[model samples]
Target: MDQKKEIKKTNDQIINSFSTELQTKVKTSISIIEEAVARYGYEGLSLSYNGGKDCLIILDLIHSIATGILPTNLTNPEKLKEIVLFYLRDEDDFEEIDEFVNTSLRSYDFRNYTKFATNSLKQGLIYILKEYPKLQGIFLGTRTADLKGRKQPIFAPTNGDWPESIRISPIMEWNYSDIWDYLLTKKVSYCELYDQGYTSLGLKSQTKQNPLLKQKNGEFLPAWVLSQKSSERDGRILSLSNSSTSTQIH
Candidate 1:
């Protein structure tokens, strides 16, 4: 009982802290983001364009702050230049993410590249380091409220080994409702997945569509597909292929 009380207290304190931080910074987040662009030099900046609502809002803010004079042209729709958009398709869902990105965002620089966050971060760092050595950093749309079982991040991550490029999150203290309010006031165009009941979007194979995920720890995959005929065939073929490859190596 004592331990439970302590845990409850900790959770309350964290929520309070985030509420306070957001109250203080909500008005100034845009200025701070603009300052980052000026301080870092726009030419050295790039956003990790994921084509999600959060990422789209950030990109829009960057454009607003720059007053139409942003350094990089990849994400700029006016430039028609290519920027990498890390995404994967859901074969079972029978819908392409690009169909949404194209019709909604009206852009083509959206490259379908990233399949997972962990792997994408590694590859993004390597690509920047190798291709654009002078690039300063990348911005992410991560928020304190987004983490499932995390202590909200307050400062930049430093102790862990990272690429020379900096990673920043200006809206880290903001919540989902806060973001929605801002989007409404600013009238920014956003991805349509949110209306369809997806809080986060990823590969169709990995992503699930349910708004109650946070409350229920819900399973996204359909139960009917569990023992489907194609999956069974693929399983056998995969096993046989592995065995044959191992025998050849031997």
Candidate 2:
């Protein structure tokens, strides 16, 4: 089949598998992207993608809309160099994530392309803005399940100390179960670490598979099986995570 047909097929499969509530959520998220692109005109907007599960969903929606499966009235760039991309790549992050991001970077063309992070997420934001000075906003994959994202509004400005930019979280209302439901049901490709029982990802040295997923067979279940939302970060060394928020999560 041709590319457009294939994209439509994939999109249909994804949408059909979602529950009615989730279907609305997905469409709302798509509309959020449409609104952002309409307001920012793609070039003025940026995508804060880092090969995480949430961002994977964000990217998929963007692809579908851009390809006309979801239909944005605006002219879809045959390639989505329309909106820019940025990621805060740290040397200490997981190799699997970096590999996935690199592979995606090649296809999506969203990199200002830096591999560094200071002691804080705010500093990372500062650097991203400095690199992409013209960007008015960025689409973040942040969800309520993430501690930093719990209180965040769907649309908000950066904190006073952080560099100024609008942070658009399309999936802000989605819960833990909602996330896994969408990813698995859509058959979206995600980072391999998730299959290894990692519910949440942090720096490679500090993060591990969720302890709560351990089974009687000396093996552990995947991230999707973790019963408690609060225990998602049980594998991470909290002290370091408290100091520096991870790029892997968003």
Best by lDDT: 2
Writing each residue's lDDT as its tens digit, candidate 1 over 97-151 gives 5465455444433322333222235455655556656656566666554443455
Tell me which residue pairs clash in candidate 1.
Answer: 86-114, 87-114, 90-204
RMSD of 1: 15.0
Model 2 scores a TM of 0.83
Clash number for each model? 3, 0
Candidate 2: how large is its RMSD? Answer: 3.5
Off by more than 4 A, model 1: 1-26, 68-96, 102-119, 148-161, 211-250
lDDT of 2 by residue, 172-208 (tens): 7777777888878767677888888888776787788
Please list the C-alpha lDDT of all candidates, in the order they appear. Answer: 0.45, 0.72
Top TM-score model: 2
| lDDT for predicted candidate 2 compared with the true structure | 0.72
